[model samples]
Target chain A: MLSLEYLQECYGFNHSKWKINGEILDTEKGVKRLTNWTEEKRVRWHVQWRDQLAEKTGCLTNRMIQTIHGERIILSDAGWVTLHDEVTSLFSYKNRENEIGAFFGRYFSLGMQDVDTEINDPYANNKLKIYLQQSFLTKNSTEEMRFLEGIRRESRLRYNKAKEIKEKAGGKQEPIVAPIRSLDQGKVVYGQFYWTNLKGRPEKGYGSLRNVLTEWLQRYGQTSLFSLLNEIDKEFSLKGYHGKNLLAECLTPWEFLEYVMKTRDVHEKDELLVWKEKLTYQWEASRLLVKALGEWLDVAQEKVTV
Target chain B: MTYEQPSSLAFSIKESVWLREGEEIDELLSLALEPDISIREADDQVFIRGSLLLFGEYKPKEQDSNSNSYSDQISFRSVEEVTMSDDGIGMIRHSFPLDVTIPREKINRLEDLYVTVDAFDYELPGKGCIELEANVSVSGIKHERTEEPEDTYDEQQDEESDDYYTRPQEYNDFSSEREEMNERSFHFEAVREAAADDETKDEYESRVEEIKGESKEFQNYERNAAFEQHYEEEDQYEQEENNEEPVSYNTDPEIEPEYEGETEPEPEPEPAPEPELVRSEPTVNFSPQPSPVSAVEETHELEEEGEEEAGRDQTEKSSSSKDENALYLTKMLTKGDQEEFSKLRMCIVQDGESLETIAERYNIQVSNLIRMNRLNEERVAEGQILYIPVKQTPTSKS
Candidate 1:
């Protein structure tokens, strides 16, 4: 995505045997990449994050190289361009769970929390009813109808539970600035996890925590979730409001909403099976996330009482 | 609030079974393993069930002269300690121990939950033995159940409800998350029209018959038309609310304006990861990123060394008639210039030496020693002889 001339002029990397391949530029210095983000704030946050992570935890992220103009991001015609010293080789961690947990622990303690707070209505799914109607029209078989009913019932229950939890927690929890790593956003490179090509907007909320934990369970399963939470607890105590907000966020039927929205493009009878499978998978991931969080909170409360 | 959360638990089972007997396994022909697994709950516990199908060629013994092949499809339960062999045809009893806890009270209404078994690392220790090691895992989700009346699609109730209309699509650059989560709605008037067409039954049948003759081409065109229509509709919706909301200034507005200038001074290069402009703390030193080498080249070098090992044993046995004066070098196969010996170097292990140090001393790769000597591991006993490879160059036949 970046030219050799740009790397030479902007970053002072002049190698005779340089070539561009995909998003990376192979130069003598290291692999330089073009990030997918153009937002100045998120880009700045990522640059600083890579620096701090490498400094504190001895983890080598793709550290941004400053241009001749002393800028991390250059405003080119193609948008914001950032050249990083990309670590290409894989680095194996001795204890993957504990080490990954330790890296995240240090990250949570980094004082870069955002102050902007605008709550999104998680229960607002006006399109779901339309999707439900469309599904009924298309898949009118008795068995399919029963399946739809079950899904609808589950969604209603999740919405009510999420509302109840939010009401109980009230506004006691202070939002923390955290990176939202969606399922496709998180990557494992250079022996550690990176929020690769981060597309999620910079935010300060408990939603990011819920999103990250959900992603971990989706990618790494339950053991990683437990170890991650436990290790993060050792550094940044996830005891009171943070814990409650995470629990409430978990109860939000984001999975059902996401899948119901997908029904707009699906028309094939066989595709409904795939649609059902994905919804079920998401539901399972969400349930396990909630269960793990519930168990963790129970243990935390016991420790507090003792 | 006391939330009705799904109970989470874990289980593990390990079982080793004799896959086959009698026939000695000659060569593993093919192994076909698919993770088409299902999870079931019984007696407040969850169990994983799957089948492993393997086909292999065997060396038939003297008594058995009919066939020299064995193909068996074995099915096993994750929880069963003792299981029947498939069809009672073979004597191989396979049962893999499984410890799995599925959160079933609320999320159990579903008929089947697919549990994926990770890729197995299989090994053959001896004849007629297949050892498979794999981790079985069930991962995340949440579902809720309640005793209210079951939800049915009531067309009358839907028509009466005020929430039938879709939201006007608004374009906002900052809130990409919200935009991604936004759903599109379509009216069901098309479905209603198709249903109420009472006078075109014969016309519809004739049209369907005509289309069936060129179904393949029609299907492609129909699929393309649907995609184009969907995209065009999305673009039209986006265009309707072209200027509904300006870019939000909620996120650090001051930072964007500051980056417009090119006057920021670069900090002195330090042995740390701290950027010059950002807030700095006491930095921890990290290892510099290693230079990227082509993984292909490394594997190529390993394969070349393997080829060299195959020819080393014959040369060692043949090179016995060496001159006493030529102390360090010996020539074994100098038939032509192409077959001349370069030189052979050997090292003896001492008390305080490792394979790595010996490699470093002789300026040869450790892999060359291991492959040449056929060493199983990196460790070497004291007073062991380690052969090192010398530089080889092509020579003309003299």
Candidate 2:
């Protein structure tokens, strides 16, 4: 029942300690701290994001997945996943290869855990995914793809430049730029949406994206990945009632795919399977693109082999 | 002796008339003839015409001796005829009657008797007057006339009557008595004036002499007392100045005690005891001879002792300086001798002596000690050592 304006005025929209797959993602810098904010402002921002998600979808629920190896798995209402296996998993899901597969395979095999069965209908996940895919295509899919592509291009450039710098310096220093994935696409899409809606004029879009990212990093990115992932789990449960419908509606297949990519990385062979699951209308649009891209890549590999 | 025939009474009657046309003369006569008759006319005419009867030697039956005896037989009448004018005054007049009678004894009692008649007379413009006739009677009884002595007695009585009319002799006596009283009063006043003059002179002389003597005596007494007081004051002033100099000098020893005897005796006795220290330390071997330099040093030392005593007194009197002196001595001893100073320090530390008490005993300033030791004066610790200055004695200058 809390309006977005009321939430924004009272709780604000800034995130605190964002995490992906149990690892903390670095925002840029100069982010305002949640502790520095009044409790009303903190709660308001939380409620705002919660409401936004709820407006798109039904009530969002959260589940904590604990692996047998003492790993933590946090699943969002849209089945976006985070794992706390290592600090590197917060930025890049490829680092948590074993833990990610264990969580996904367990969920697929067990169908629903006892904790998840207690809070939600056992059959709600399949319906929820379908709802998320429809909403993404209708409302957020194109924007999500655009945002993910921009972020991917930017991250690739940054990684290449960092790698080049390290090579030229002849140092063993790791690259400073984090790897990109489609899971970051959700945040990028929302960030760009916020930029356009909150900060952008018609004359200037994405004018303050860097500043926004910088502030997010400094304020909410200081905590460890495990704590951040736990906090995101709590945020999903707390925001379930408010932003469930909104998120259910706005989380399209592209957004879900982006969420999954940023949250979980796949090998090249499994990429098509991930695309097939996310894109609901295989005959309509994304299946063609996927097939064409797969054929072009096969041809290129064959050329390289020859 | 033939009594002269007493003359018969000759009586006459007079009538005076004024006819106013038929006035009867007989009526006038008839009226005149009445007994005890008297006729009067309007024109101032009077007539007496009454019978006089002779009664030779006959006394009347009812006659009393106290009454007068006289012949009563006489008659006179007179009538005057006058022409009355219109104013009723008579212009022309005629007398008509007269009567007379004589008794056997001549009546000689009448001397200057006169009868007067008054009548109304209009023409005369005033009341009328009477005409009088004089008569003299003589008796033939006296052959020789003699003066009686009784008459002379009467004449003398009459002359003595003038004396009654004048003032009596007692008036002169009263006047003289008044004059004498006045004289006595004058004499009394003069005597009182003289007595007052004598009293004033005597009082003025005695007062002048008394004042003069008292003034001289007062001047002498005042001069003697003033002289005595002047000498006493001078002596007292000099003694006070002398006393004050020593007290003030003792108060501030920067002004040295010039009186050697007063200051030296106490310190000399005390300093004599310190010689045992010199004797006991024979190895130190300080010279025993009291050289001139030693004397000078001793005097300086004595002066220092005096100054220190003064300072001690000041410190004792003043609460502020007690600590200062202790600190000063502690500093001095510490600066000069470290081991001995440390022993003193140990004493202070062990004895738990207060800074002020230590200051007084050591003859040093407490502040200086605190500064040297780098200790807070307010919080001096136990086991802190303080140095004490040795006080030296004074010697005789001679």
Candidate 3:
């Protein structure tokens, strides 16, 4: 519901560029423009603005950018709010069939080959349009781990704050849990310049929530601390995932995980005997999750409308 | 029994087809065309699948005007030939797939097809795909199967020879005035409105017919004419003679052919085309851009000639009157005829020969004539020399 007028007047987002990415320049809605070569000179001002929000909140967060009122504007200062856990399992090297197979899900689409591959081949000698920079592959790449740790603490704190506010108001209002909406129609191939966590940020920021979660597991070591509560069964079921008994009312990610790990007893004859593997990190998994939590908020509409 | 005379017909049609146009501003820098062609014949329909593989090294344009910009374009194109089945319905729908329903009735074959890039450029300044507009010319050729009487061979040949001259859009700038001039009198319409004056319709048409026949003969005679003509001649520049009596095109051209006796065995020079900038090599020692005369004033001059012709000579068929007929037809040359005439000429600019006199003789722009030969002076003394681009004729070519 935030208006560009509010963005300009209040936040001083006066820059003509980033505030206009995916903007419907023509009066007729038929033409959609992507300023593919804009090089982030204009949009960086807005991203820097988001950095200020992070500075004030003391929590690093990314904006969910989209088009409304025929202009591309940030909907929320935080794109990732509600955390998901299974996405980390998907990114695990143990789960994948091949060394590079883990990168093939929603995140890995089209990308330029390595610089050497491009130099040898006559046709494609240009730098990649979308891919993680080689610098991320270096041995001491702990920046990703730091990013995940920051988000885990931030989400746990936010969930606790939302619960406190709800309890204080006698449970009359909904809690603050931000879910994700797919960027570029859930496409990662040739992702345009606009699909970034912030201006000049790598496209890894805009990968599918599952893909980004997997990336965290590879770089930050396996963790399930960020999974939101889901429907998990007692003593685990044959489905391996006990999502049936996962979500508990008004609890944060790691809080719900700790509750499940403690309640589910180890029975020798249980068909889902391997449920302990997911809880290996005990109460310290730190992955992100996203779902249609907005559906839960509109409880009346969901019950009557199909 | 009717004898079938071979009819040469070329069909020209325009169709808008999608072309593969892209621009990689940061990568490979050149433009080349590669095509994948598929020809399929299915129940009364021919489907042609065509994909163009456009690849090239793209050198970024020089940002500064003072720098060299020699690598502007690379001449790269791919042409493919595929057999298409003609449907019974003569209407063909040609798409990028080249999927078309070609009428099988009259078309003997798709003799030749060529595509020209009519217009192409970048629509956006910064980063965007290139916009290319190409004109695809598909010539569906058919032959006339009608039989001719043996005695009428000469008459039929005259009529059949006209296909050599009917071309599209190559006219002098002033030729646009023809449509307006045609409204003044229908008789002028029959003249080469392209070259038409206030002459009688019969006289003009007859003259155009003569030019067509002569041009066809010249093309046949000088197939390799462009390669062999190497003659050394001094520069012959003449000053403008706008002050003198306007030269009439009604002079007996056969009288001018007396000079042909001197260069009888030399190779005939073909017409110099305009926009010679596109060609790699210059054809003429000095290339003068040809210009047709303005109609309003030229028409008035022609009306005077027409009256003089009517008073002095009759349109008789005697051998004596053939020169008059030649003179009448020489003025109404078709597009191809005009091209045949733009050959190199070394005119010893005599005392009376002025700029207009030589320009009218060559049928080229007086300004361009001056620029091409680099005419240095305003006045022409005896033997001051000029390169008059006289129209090549049977007599002139040797």
lDDT of 3 by residue, A1-306 (tens): 233354343333344223243332222222223222233333433333344433433323333233334333333433311100011111122322222222222122222112111011111321221111112123442433232223233334334433332343342211111112222221221221112232332222112233333333434432221221011111112012111111212223433234334433534434222333343332232222222221222232233356
Off by over 4 Å in 3: A1-306, B1-24, B41-96, B106-126, B143-398
- Top-DockQ candidate index: 3
lDDT winner, 1 or 2: 1
What lDDT score is found at residue A13 in candidate 1? 72
lDDT of 1 by residue, A96-148 (tens): 66776676667666655543333233334466444433333233345545455
DockQ category of candidate 2: incorrect
Rank candidates, DockQ, best first.
Answer: 3, 1, 2
Q: What is candidate 3's fraction of native contacts?
A: 0.00
Put down candidate 2 lDDT per residue, A236-292, tens digits, no spaces.
Answer: 221222112111111112333344444345445466455534432321222222222
Clashes per model (N, Cα, C within 3 A): 19, 80, 40
- Which regions in candidate 1 have their CA more than 4 angstroms from the true location? A16-22, A48-58, A88-94, A109-111, A115-146, A173-197, A204-208, A211-224, B1-398
lDDT of 1 at B46: 45
Ranking by TM-score: 1, 3, 2
